[model samples]
Target chain A: MIIVETKNLSKVYNPDTVPVHALRDVNITIEKGEFTSIVGPSGSGKTTLLNMLGGLDKPTSGEVMVNGEKITGMKDSRLIDFRLKNIGFVFQHYNLIPVFTARENVSFIMLLQNRDKNEMMKRTDALLEQVGLGDRKDARPKEMSGGQQQRVAVARALASEPKFILADEPTANLDSNSAMNLLDIMERMNREEGVTFIFSTHDQRVIDRARRVIKMVDGAIAEDTLISVEAANQ
Target chain B: MKTLLTIAWRNIWRHPARSGVLIAAVVAGLWAGVVTVGVLNGMMDQRLNNLIESELTHIQVHHPEFLDEGYSRLFIEKVDEIAAFLKQDERVKAFTKRTITDGMLQSPVKTSGVRIRGIDSESETRTTNFHTNMMEGEYLDSSIPNAVIIGRTMANEHNMELGHRVVLTFEDVSNQLTSSAFNIVGIFESAGTDFDRRNVFVRSSDISSILYDKAVFHEIAIMLHDEPFAQSLAADINQNFSGITAQTWRELSPELNLIVEFGEVMLYLIMLIIMAALAFGILNTMLMALFERMREIGMLISIGMSRTRVFLMIMLEAIVLTLTGAAAGILLAIFSIRYLSSAGVNLERFAAGIAELGWDHMIYPIMSTPEYVTVVIMVIVITLLASLYPAAKAIRINPLEAAKDS
Candidate 1:
C-alpha cells in the first residue's frame, strides 16, 4: 500500500519581495517498506521536498496524505504531533541531544511519546544492539565516533515506529569506511525489519543502495528510476 | 514531564561559567535585599519600642484644654478618680500622674525653654521605665528638697553637673508667674536627643506647691500589658470618662505611625528593585542559552515535543536556576540575621545622628517568616516573568529552517 503521497506540492520563499521557488509542482509516492533516494546537485530542492513530505515545512499549494490523512493545512501543534507519530527525521549532523547518553538518545523519542518505562528500556537496548552499539549504550555522543552516532540517530528515528524516515545526507560527514558501515546498518534494518526510508543525498553509496532513485535538477524532477533486485544486488 | 525536566536540568549546566554567574547574581541580590530589609525592620522596631516604653507609654489622658492650651489652670479635675480606675483596671499594667508645665530652665549661663514634668518618682518609674535611663545620679530623690532630673543632652549643652542648682519659672494656677529653685540630682540619656533636650523631671510636691492652690495633675500616662489593646482601651477611657481626652501612642506620635506604615512599602520597593535586576540577569542568560541551542530546540519540537512543553522546559530551567540561588541566599540571610539579632550591629560611630532621629544606635536585625515567604514568592514570579521572552523564542524556532541552517 502507498504509505505516503504528495500531490501538486510547491514552495516559494520570499514570494512578496523576490520570490524563490524552492519546489515546483512536485509529486511523489512511496510504498510501505520502500528504501528510496532523491538525488540532485546543491540547491536543487531535494531537502525541501523531504521537508514537505515529512510535514516539517508547509507547501505553497498542495496536499500531503500520509496513511490516508490529509496533513497540508494542519495546525502547527497538531502537525508536530502527526510528525511525531508518523514521520521520523535524520539530519546531516547527528543531532543526538549532546547531553543524553547513547541509550537515552535512542529511548528519548519513546519517552516523548510517553511510552511505558519497561518497554522503552527493552526496545532501547534491542535497538542499540541492532545498530551494533550495545556496549556503548552508556557513552554520550561526544564519546562516540561519527558512524556510531549516526547509527544511534537511526535507532532514534525508528524508536517512534514511524511509517517512513526522512534522512537528509545521512553519510555526508563520514569517511568512506564509516559511511559504508552506516549504510550497511540502515540497509540491514530496511531488509530485515521492513523499515521504510527516504534519503536526500549526493553520496553515491547511498544512491547505489536505494531500490528507487528520483533525480531533481532546478527544483523539478528530471528522472525517476526503479532498480530491479538483480541490479540492486550488482 | 520527566523527560522535559531532565532535559531542562541538564541544559542549564551546559555553560557552567555563565550559569554560575547568573546564580551568583541572584544570590547576591536576594541576600542584599533581605538583609537590608531586616536591618530597617530592626531599626523601626527598636524605635517604636523606645517610644512606647520609655516615652509615650501605651495610652495617655489629659485635660481637654491642657494639650491644646498649656494653661496651668487647665488641669484634669478628677485625677484621683482616674488613677483609682486605672489602678483597678485589668489591662493597665502601670499608670502615673504628672503635673506638666511649659517653663524656662535657667542654668546660670544659659536659660532655655523646657517642658517640666512633675511626677511621683515611684509611679513614674513603673509606668514609663524612666529610672533605667539614668546616666549619672539618682532619679527624683525627695530627700533632696526640690530635686530634679535633667537629660544628658540638656545638661551637656548647659555645662551643668549633678548637684548643680537651676531655677524653673512658669505660670501659676491663678495666672501669676512663679519661680522655684531645684537641685539637678540626675542626668539621664534616652534614644531621642530632642526629647532629652526639651524635657526635665521634678518632684510633684515641689512644683505643685509653687504652681497650684490645690493638687492638680495635667497628664495621666498608662502602660498596658498588651500593646494591641491600646487603641480599644483608649477608646474605652474616652467613652467612660468625662472632661478628659485619651490618646494612643500611635495617635500621639503620627510620625512613628507613618514610619511603620511607609516602612512596609519601602521594603517591597527595595525587593522589587533587587528582583528586577535579578530578572534581567536571568533573562539575558536564558536568551543566550536559547540562541546557542536553537537547532537542538528545533529538533525537540520537530520530534513532537509540544510548544507548551518547550515553553515549560525553558521555564523550569530558569526556575531551577533561580531557586537554587534563592535557597542559598535565604539561608545565608537567615543565618546572618540571626547572628546579628543576637550580637547586635552597633552604629556608635553615627550615634549622635541616630539619636537625633529618635533611634537607638545599636540595632538588632530581624526578619519575620512572612517576609521570607514573600521573598520566595517574588523569586518565583520574577523567574517566570524573566523566562518569558526566551521560552517564547525557543518555541517560535522553525524546525525546518533550524535544521537547514545546521
Candidate 2:
C-alpha cells in the first residue's frame, strides 16, 4: 500500500558558488490511507523532502517513485500530468485562488481533469459540504477567515481524487480555536475517507493529531514512528 | 479553456484601481488618435472635392496643340457631334466647351497677363461653379456685344468697377494681331485669390469670330456622377474620339493626388504610435500583476495547470483589457465624430491659410467602417504582442523557490 517512496534522495542549492545541502541522502516511504507528519526545525529540510516526494522539485540525485512509477526522469510536461492524476498540495498561507469563490476553487482541479459537469458539481458540492463551507460556497477567499480558506484548499486538493495530499505547515498561521477546528476536520477525514496525507509542520496540534511522525535532523531521517492503532483507539 | 478565461478575466480586477487606470489610458489614447486622424483626413478630402467641383471637372478633352500658346490653330473641330455624344452618355453629368487664348488685359491704371476663356454661358455654369461665383454684375450675356467677366482680385488691383471697359489683344486665325475693347460685366472670387487673378471669362461668340467658326473650341470640360470612374471614362473617350486627348483630374492636378497619399500615410503612422504607447501601458500592468502572484502561480503550476494554460491566462487577461478599452474608445469616437460631422468644424478662422491648399471654410469629419475595423485589429495585435514577455516570465517561475518563505 505504499503510495510514495524516496530512496537516497539529496538536494544541493548553489553547488558551485556556495554549496548548501538542503536534503542529504534522505530515505522515506508513505503508505496509502496513512495520516503522517514530517517534523523538523527551520532549515532542517522538511520542505525539501516534501517537495521532492510530490514531484514539485527535482532532487540533485536519487529516485522518487509514486504509486510504483519513477518520476525523477519524467519530462516536465509529463510530470505535470502525472502530478495532476496522482498528487494534491496545500500551502501554509491558504493559497486558494483569490478571484474564485469557494465552490469554484474546489471545482478547479476537476475542471483540469475534464470531469463531467454533473459529476464534478456533485463532487465539488460534497467536498465543500464535508469541509463545512457548503453555505459559503459563493464566498471568495478574501471574504473567508484564514481557517475557512485552508478548508477550501483542502477541498480543492481532494477534487481530483489524488492518491496523496502533501501539506506544508498547514496550520502554522491559524489561531488556537481555528487550528483545533481545522485539525478536527482533517483528522475526521483521515479516519472516515481513508485519504492519504503527508504534512511538513512545526505545529504541535497537527503533530498530535497525526498517526505517524517522521522526524528529521540535519537533512537526514532520525525517527519514523507509527501510532495509528494506539492513536485511533484514544 | 473556459475556466482559464474566466480566471484570467477575474484576475485583472484584483486591483481594480490599477486596472481602471490602465483601461482609462487606453480609452483616452484611442479617442484622441481617432478624432485627430478623422479631422485631418476630412480636410484633405474636402480640398480634393472642391478642386473637382469648383475648378477642374472630372475629365477634360483638349486639342493636341491646345497646351501651347498658339490660340489660333489649337481648336477642336466636330464640336456639335461631341456635344451630342456627351448629352447621350449616362455617366456624363454635365459638359462645357470653351475657346482659350493667352492675352493681356489693359485698364487705365495697370495691365496683367491672363488666360482669356470664351465660355458659352449656359453650358459653362452647368459644368463648373461660374454662375454661383458671381460677386457683382452678371454672368456672360451673348446679347451684350463684347461682354466679359473678371475675377474680384484683378478688378481691385486695377481699381475697376462694374461696367468698366478693358482692352484685350490676341492673334486671329490668320495669325494677325487683333485687339478689341470689352465691358467687365461680372467679378467673381472662388476658393483661391491666386487662381482668380490669373483668369478672365467672356462669351465664346465674342472672341471666336476672330479665331475660327463660332462653334470651334480649344477645350471641353466634363463632370461625371461618380468621380472615381473618370480615368476609365477618359480612356473610353480617348479610344473613340479622334484628334483630341482626354485627361482625368488626377492627371491634370498631380499635387492634389500627392496630398491624398501623404495624408493617408500620416494618419496611419499617427495611429501606430498611439497604439504602441497603449501597448506599453498594458505590458507594464500585466507584468506587475503576474509578479505579485508569483507564488500563487507557482502553486497553480504545482497543482497541475499546464505551462501553456498559464501563458494563455496572462495573454487572455491582456486581450480582455484592450478589448474593453478599445470598445469604449470606439463608442466615444463614433458619438463625437457623428456629432461634429453633422455640426461641421469651421475653418474660416484658418481660411486664408487653408485656401492656399484649395480647402473650404467648413469641413465635415468622417470615418469609414473599414477604418474602424483596422483600428480594432491593430489594437488587438498590439496587445497580443505586448503580452509575450510577461507570459514567458510567468512560465519560467520556479514553484520551489516561490513556495519558500524568504
Candidate 3:
C-alpha cells in the first residue's frame, strides 16, 4: 500500500521576473516500510521534492497525501503539528544541538512531544544503543567523530518513533568510510524497524542501499527503478 | 516553552563579543536610569525634610476660610478644644498654636513691612528645630509682651542692637489700629527665601492681648510621631474640624512639588532616550547574530521547530540580556549611591555658582527605598518594551530564505 503519494507537484520561483520552475508535474509514490532514495544533481529540485513530501514546504500546485492526510493544503500550524507528531528528519550536517549530549540530542524530539523525563531517558538510551552509540551517550557532537555524529543523528530521527524518517543529503559532509557506515546503519534500520526511509541524495552508496531509486535530471524524473523488487515484496 | 528558553540561552552565548556588548549597553542604561532617579529623589527628600523641620510641620490646621484666602482676621477662637483632641491621638506627638500677621516695623532710620509670627514660645520651640536657627538672640519670651526675635537680615537693615526697640504698627483682628514697641532680643537665620527674612517672632500672649481676643489663633501646627502617617492624620484632623482645613507640608509647598515633578519628568524622558539608544545597540547585536547564524536557525526550523519557538528564543535572549544588565546596574548604582549618601555629595565647591543662581549651597541627594524599587521595575519594563522589534523579526524569518543565506 502506498504510504506516501504526490500528484502533479510543481514549484515556481519568481514568476514575474525570472520565472524559474524548480519542479514540474512530479508524481511519485512510496509503499509502506520501503527505503526510497531520490537522486539528482545540484539544482535538480531533489531537496524541494523532499521538502514537499515532508510538509516542510508547500508546492505551488500539488496534492501530498501522507498517511491518508492531504498535507499540502493544510494550515501552517497544523502542518507543524503533523511534522512534530508523525515525521523525523536527518540533515547533512548532523545538526546536533552543540549544548546537548548525544543522548540528549536523541531525546530532544521526545522532549518536544512533552514526554516525561524518565521515559525520555529510557527511550534515549535504548535508541543510542540501537544506533551503536551506547558508550558515547554523554558525548557532545563536537566530541564525536563524523560517523558517530551521523549515527547519533539517525538515532535522533528514530527516537520519536515516527512513521517516516526523511534524510536530506545525510552523508554529503562525511568521509567515504563514515558515509558507508551511515548508509549501512540506515539500511539496517529500514530492514529491522520497518521505519520508512525517504532520502534525497546524490551519494551512490546511499542510492545503492536504497530498495528503490528515483532518478531526476533537470527538473523532472528521469527514471524510477526497483533494485530488489522481489525482496521488497517479501 | 522551556525548550525554547534552553535554546535561547545557548544562542545568546554563540557570539560572546556581540552579546557582551548588548549586555553592557543594557547595564549602562539601567545604571543611568537608576542613579539619576535615585539622586533626584534623594535631593527632593532632603528639601522636604528641611521644609518640615525648619518651617512647616507635618500638618497645619487653620480656620476654614483663613487657609484658603490667607485672611488672618478669620483666626479661630477656643483652639484648646482642637489641641486637646490632637493630644489624645498617639500619632500627634506635639501641637502648637501661632498668630501670623503682616505689619510694618519702624526704627529711627529704617522702615520695612514685616510678617509677625506670634508663637506660644515654649510650645513652638519644642515642636520644631527653630531654636537651632537662632543666630545672636534669645527665642521668644512668652512672659514678656514687648520682646521680639527678628531675622538677621532685618536686624542688619535697621542697624539695630539687642537693646534697641522697634515700633510695630498693624491693624489687629478687630480692625483697630495698634502700635507696640518691641525690644530686639535676638537674631534668627532660617535659610529660606525672602519670606523667612521678613519674619519677626513674638509671644502669642502679646499678639492676643493687642488683638483683644486671647482665645484666637491663626494656625495650629501638629507634629506626627510617624511622618508617613501624616496624610492620614491630616485627613482625620480635617474630619474632626468640619469647617477648617488641615494641610500637610506637601500641600503648602506646591512650587516644591512642581520642581520635584519636573525633575522626574525630565528623568523619564532621558530614560526613554537611553532605552531607545540601548535598544538600537541590542537590536544590532541580535540581528548581527541572526545574520551570522542564518544556516543554524534554518536548520533548527527544518528539524520541526516552529518559527514561534525561534521567536520566543530570541525574546528570551533579550530579556536575559536586559535582566542581567539590570542586575549589574542596580548593584553598581546602589553601591555608589550608598557611599555617596553616607559621606554626602558636597556641592560646596560649586557653592558660589549655585548661590548666584539662588539655589541651596549644600545639596544632599536623598534616594528613599521606594524610589530605588521604582527604578528597578522601570528598567525591566523598558527593557521588555525595547526587545519587541527584534523578537518579532526573529519570528518572521523564513527558514527557506535563511537556509539560502550565506
lDDT of 3 at A130: 80
Task: Please name the candidate that would achieve the greatest lDDT relative to the true structure.
Answer: 1
Q: Least accurate stretch of 10 residues (summed lDDT) in model 3 chain B?
A: B397-406
State in Å the error of residue B61, model 2: 1.6
Residue by residue across B1-406, what tens digits does model 2's lDDT show?
Answer: 8998899889888999998998899899999888887887788887777677776899988887777555667788767777888889889999988888888899999989888888888987788875777889889853778998998888989999998999998887767787899998989877777777888998887889867655568888999998878988899888878998889988878898898898778668988999889888999998999878988888888999888888998899999888888999989998888998989888899988876555767888888888888889889889999998999999988876446663
Off by over 4 Å in 2: A232-234, B68-72, B78-81, B169-178
lDDT of 2 by residue, A110-137 (tens): 8888999999999999999999999999
Residues B1-406 of candidate 3: C-alpha lDDT, one tens digit per residue? 7766777677777777777877787777777776676666666666666667766888888887876665557887548778888888999878889987778899998789887888877888778777787888688753545889987767777788787899988778777778999988878866554544578988877877887655468889888888888899889878777767888877877877787687768567767777778767767777776676666666666666677777777778777777777789778878877877777767778765543333555555555676667666776676566677776776566555422525
lDDT of 1 at B291: 84
After superposing the true interface residues, what Cα RMSD does each candidate give?
A: 1.2, 1.2, 2.7
Error of 2 at B42 (Å): 1.3
Clash statistics: count for each candidate: 0, 0, 4
Clashing pairs in 2: none
lDDT of 1 by residue, A72-124 (tens): 99999999999889988888888889989999998998988889999999999
Q: Order of candidates by DockQ, top first? A: 1, 2, 3
Mind giving the per-residue lDDT tens digits that candidate 1 earns over B1-406?
A: 7777788778788889999998888888889999999999999998988888886899989988787799989899888888888888899999988888999999888999999999998888888877889999998865999999999899989999998999999999888988888899999999999999999999887788888767888989999999889989998888989999999988888998998897788789999999999999999999999888888888888878788988999999999999989999999999999999999999999999999998999999899999999999999999999999899888899887446555
- What proportion of true contacts does candidate 1 retain? 0.69
